[model samples]
Target: MAERVAGILLAAGSGSRLGQPKALVELGGETLAQRGVALLQDGGADPVILVTGAVPVTIPEALAVHNPDWSTGMGSSLATGLHALAETDAEAAVVALADQPLVGAEAVRRLIAAYAGGASVAVAAYDGKPRNPVLIARGHWPAVIELATGDTGARAFLRARPGLVTQVECGDTGSPDDVDTAEDLARVRGVATVRSEEKS
Candidate 1:
């Protein structure tokens, strides 16, 4: 039987450092939120959920859930997303961050494939370090939400259960760098430009 996996996009952050909503930030002509949804869909995540806060964003392709406690931190957004997922038929979820526009579908697909291969927890690793776009089986959602607090998200929970995690090396598939500052955004834009030039 095929496992039903969903995509949970955390885009509720206020982006205080960038002085704007990161979800609205544009990369290669697409908003960060839009890019996130596309990546998840293209990567094979069915029924993508976008947890929004800080600022309102409407993406036709995603089921946007507003996190009223978003100001609290990434944990709140993650909790909100997980809570929303509980009502669905998803057996697992691939969590992605909106700021990480550089994380492509290939990385997400790898995580999903890992989860499909009996891995309870799957994470993308770049240069031996685990990064965003983690896959969490439904059985671990409760523990993950319990440990998810402040900006920690699922790090604490994943750390506590390192033995269950399967790391998918995706260094060549995508970059985990997030756009948290103006300089970072510029760098992403530069990369986008280079990519566009190559495609042209």
Candidate 2:
């Protein structure tokens, strides 16, 4: 049986940099949070969690629950999502970011596959540096809960224990283009447009 995987879309950032809720930003006919949810669902995750805060807003149907404590920091939201994931039949959890509206569905799938293949934590590594859209196996959930903080997800935990971390090099630039500032959003839109044209 394929182990069930949970996906946590960390969309609770205050968006101080962009001066707006990043999750609500529109991209390719959908909101950033919506895109994150879609990517997780397409990646085979069940009970995807949308961690929210700042200005509370409506979430998509696929999103399991929202964390109100998002103001406290990313750790609070991570803990909230982890607690909810513990209730579901998920064998592992993937922590994604709503600001990263361009993380491809295939990249998420690769992370999950690597996690299922016995990796404690499989993260998308782009340009020789690992980034979010991280998949955490059940064995590493504790660490995720421990190090998740202030818009910084599980990276600290992974870095603190390098031996247990698995880097899944996905040839994707979208993973690094997280929309934090107005300029970032514009850049991502340009990139998305270019990619869309290529596909056509």
Candidate 3:
């Protein structure tokens, strides 16, 4: 199968809860944005687009393009990213958030695999709850674009179009844990420390 999927990383949030730029926050020696990009790269997605707005003036050169309207909401960023994908010949796209460091390369692989297996949309069902890091087939892109508004993302739209989605299970607890607050960051650090200790 030829590569037909693209990766879209939404990184333009105000970070009001985090009190700083969450995308630039360091995690496991890499920024959240970098980690998100790496996941897409590792998953074999071509031409990943990183959308930024709230604080995206200095996005790294590695990201194909950064949307400055990120402050409007995830929906605007999603619309922008999806539109960018439309320009490409991609059959689908894997949409993710920069704050989700736990959505590592393995998770992305599973998402793409599920979508490739015929799911019009493949979303991560972490802890039995569907969230970001979803794979949207070309046929479902319009719905995704239509349902996005304000800060709202594709969850509601995905829910409305239940017939097209196939949920995939992810093994990591962090896969669902987005770093939105100071406590969330602390928790992530703690988990990383524990994992490091176990490895040693």
Candidate 4:
């Protein structure tokens, strides 16, 4: 049997810049947190975990884990998420951002495919630039936790080992835009609404 990979959604940001918690932000008639969980599950991640910091969220489909050090930065949330995955049988984790609603399941599947093909670190790339929904093998979680601090998350660790990463192009799958401000929210909501309507 193939090894399992968990999906970790970082939703702990206070969203102070956006005037509300990004997790609760609505898009396409669903909260960002809800949408994130669905995307991860649909993309083949087993036992999806959501790391919330600024405020507690209750999403029935996901195992919600709180990061008490959320105020410190994204690194804390990443650590908390990894810690939550420690007890699971997951061989790796696919990290996704709660605010990035446009990042679709196809990107995640691609990252998983890379990991299954022997890549220890897989990252979604937009136009050749590294983006969100990165896949981190279990072997690197400890080091990632050590380097993850403030808003850096796993960036510093990933940067230190560039040769190990497998970048998968996902420009055709979806956008990596995140809603960090009211203007950004409005823009993303508009886009989401249009897409939802088209699907309906």
Q: Write the per-residue lDDT of candidate 3 for residues 102-162, one digit (tens) a residue.
A: 7667777888888777787898887777886889888778888999988778877887888
Residue 38 C-alpha lDDT in model 4: 92
lDDT of 1: 0.93
Candidate 3, residue 177: the lDDT equals: 78
User: Per-residue CA lDDT of candidate 2, range 76-192, in tens?
Assistant: 888888887887788998888888877888888888889778886888988778887888887678767878777566767877888887888876545557787999999999988
lDDT of each: 0.93, 0.81, 0.80, 0.94
Candidate 3 off by > 4 Å:
57-61, 172-174, 197-200
Give candidate 1's error at residue 190 in angstroms: 0.5
Which has the higher lDDT value, candidate number 1 or candidate number 4?
4
Error at 2, model 1, angstroms:
0.7
lDDT of 4 at 100: 97
Candidate 4 lDDT tens digits, 1-200: 99999999999998999999999988877999999999999999988999998889989999999999999999999999999999999999999999999998999999999999999999999999998999999999999999999999989999999999999999998899989999999998888878878889
Best by lDDT: 4
Candidate 4 lDDT at 190 equals 85
The pairs that clash in candidate 1 are none
RMSD of 3: 2.0
lDDT of 1 by residue, 1-200 (tens): 79899999999988999999999998888999999999999999989999999999999999999999999899989989999999999999999999999887999899988987889899999988999889999999999999999999999999999999899999998788889999999998998788779879
RMSD of each: 0.8, 1.7, 2.0, 0.8
- Candidate 1's C-alpha runs over 4 A off are none
